[model samples]
Target: YYQEEFAIRRTLISCLDWCDILRIWDVDALL
Candidate 1:
């Protein structure tokens, strides 16, 4: 259970990081 929880947290953080990066890219494209 602990391992699974840790994996999920890592995945969530990674996904959030990707989202931030994509948002930056999208803004750059618009400008």
Candidate 2:
């Protein structure tokens, strides 16, 4: 559900530093 996704995104943002977040997106683009 949308709420579940929002919670997951919030947790991910809290857990990862900004640079780590960019790295994750970069890796996803590579895949």
How far does residue 30 in candidate 1 sit from its true spot (Å)?
Answer: 0.6
lDDT for model 2: 0.90
Between which residue pairs do clashes occur in model 2? none
- Pairs in steric clash, model 1: none
Candidate 2 regions with alpha-carbon error over 4 angstroms: 17-31
Q: Over the stretch 6-28, how does candidate 1's per-residue lDDT look in tens digits?
A: 99999999999999999999999
The TM-score measured for candidate 1 stands at 0.92
Give lDDT: candidate 1, residue 1: 100
Q: What is the C-alpha RMSD of each candidate to the true structure, in Å?
A: 0.4, 8.1
Expressed as tens digits, the lDDT of each residue in 4-27 for candidate 2 is 999999988877777788899999
